[model samples]
Target: MTSNTAMIPSFTPSMNPSTKGTDHGVEDGVTGEKLLFFNYHEYSVKNYRLIGENTEDFHEQALIITHFPNFHVPRDSNTFEGTRIVRISRYFKGVGVFVPQFSPYLPGTEPAAIFGDDDTNAKFIVQGEYMGQFFGTSSYSPLSEYLTEKEFREIVEEINVQLRDAYNSWSLINLLLFVLDLLSFWIMSDLIHSLSKRKLDALFNFIDTRNKSLEKRGIKIISPRDSGFLSVCIVSTVKT
Candidate 1:
């Protein structure tokens, strides 16, 4: 059997009209309403341990059994679309064994029956109803007992601070990379435009020199738009 306890409080406020000739709720010659506030109430829960009888007669060389909840691994399109079920079991030889009493039993004898111990002595199982369907275990070594509320809060605050600092650093790095990408694009575009314009200017200069040589030999070339056909006319030179 397992039990869970949680405490929460609700706040409610009521307003009342102010009395005449009382300056307690008066502002700018107008009487303001008074509020009745109720404070929050707190409660605590007592912790208890369960002790049960051991009915199974097992040998002394039996391994200690610990049961954890079933877990599910999410599958994606890369793998499978369904969830995968998994269960885990941990075996301990000497450590994590809870012996209720010290008994001088033989190696083949049942420790639970010989020492009259309960089921808690040889097994540790967490109920799935209380701790959800999937629960994983983590170790905070050197600390045996559960942490206090203040200690847990402090650890959470420290983790949040570290995460914020990391986010800011990543933001700065992304900003720098974005700026460098823009600068590279602009420089490449300007270089290509300059090279294209230089080649265009060189081609125009060659065409202009050829036109001048033809004119010196008394040949006048007319454009297709002016002569209706691309044609060259021989000009008569009047030499005085």
Candidate 2:
């Protein structure tokens, strides 16, 4: 069954949220297996640039699947609005296949297409949900300092492999996609990490206040609306 896991997170008008009209129409893709063993949460937020030559919509998306990124999650999730439903599968698992897993999504922007060749061995259908602005118009942290240049290059190459195979557009377009993903990842790694840190901090603060040692605490705020980014998650017991 389709689930909406986000309470309406307030849309900040000061941020001046705006929606990018769907270059394509909305679609409903169904008829596939679904594995939701681990509780997965995700958030999709849209960003807009007001300083560019012309104010334009900037989209981004983030996700955190449970278990491992190797497990297959059938295409059963629906797109909410501006978010494009995209799935990546390296190992294709079928319907009748049993897996114990879950994946959580994060806030991000959506691109025209993804280079997801390794995304195979399974089938999925993405349906559009929301179509307007997905996030507050203004707000973002500067790119964080993570992974050395060597590590960053490695990731860029890995992501490019998928894009080159999926979209049969052109070399120039492929190059452009790679550049965007690189910059986007730099920003997103920071975004997701900060949220995680905040959650952990809050949990610890709560424990100290209560004078109770923590046995376990798992809590994260993940937005599941706004189409600029994807929030689909899959849970499984394999490593990618």
Candidate 3:
């Protein structure tokens, strides 16, 4: 669905250093260099009322589409090289087709003019000019050259379904792991308690046998307070 309204892209002179009047190889009217520019288009999408609810959904969908078979691996990890399909899926997601009420416009247009800076305008203008050149001006649509709106929607929905399935699978795995961890902890605690009890029982048995032997020899060990005396008597008896 091509719009009848022609999008006239414009870029600031600062964006194109060639447009600046040079004085002895140095650009004239040059100010301090800007490292980063605020992107109005990104801000608009992030704060859009219609897309707010689906923003997280779209991000999850993008994640699944980009990393389909490799969900187990972290995205920042260098192990997985992006394939052609992955790159295509990422591009499709970035196109904002699934984002509700998203209207793609060339630079210096309504949203861009309202929210974008020089850098944002320059960026979009370059992209639009390139696309216009690649695809003929008469048949250029902002959506896609190959896929229709319906086809694109179908693909997005299919990817979303896959994403949901993956989330469910991961949730189940996490639950199983948690249960296993609890079970293991319980078993270890029980084993340690059992071992401690056995050792304590053996120590008490040894003390009882010693007490009985002392009693048979007319040396009656009465209370825990007499442990020092018992030690002395035992040492004396051992020496004898």
Which candidate leads the pack in TM-score?
3
RMSD of each: 38.1, 22.9, 34.0
TM-score per model over all chains: 0.20, 0.17, 0.21
For residue 192, model 2's alpha carbon misses the true position, in angstroms, by 37
Please give, for residues 1-240, the per-residue lDDT of candidate 3 as tens digits: 121221112224222222212221211223422111111221111211122233222121110011012222355654222211111112112223332111222212221122222322232111111201211111112223223445434543443343333334245654565466588975654434333234335444544665676444422222211332111111111100
Clashes (backbone N, CA, C under 3 Å), per candidate, total 0, 41, 0
Cα lDDT tens digits for candidate 1, 122-163: 212221111122111111101112223344234323322332
Best by lDDT: 3
What C-alpha lDDT, on a 0 to 100 scale, does residue 91 get in candidate 3? 17
Query: What is the model-wide C-alpha lDDT for candidate 3?
Result: 0.26
What C-alpha lDDT, on a 0 to 100 scale, does residue 42 get in candidate 1?
11
lDDT of the candidates, in the order given = 0.23, 0.25, 0.26
N/CA/C clash count, model 1:
0
Ranking by lDDT: 3, 2, 1
Clash list (residue pairs), candidate 1: none
Candidate 3, residue 125: Cα displacement in angstroms equals 15
TM-score of 3: 0.21
Evaluated at residue 188, the lDDT of candidate 3 is: 52
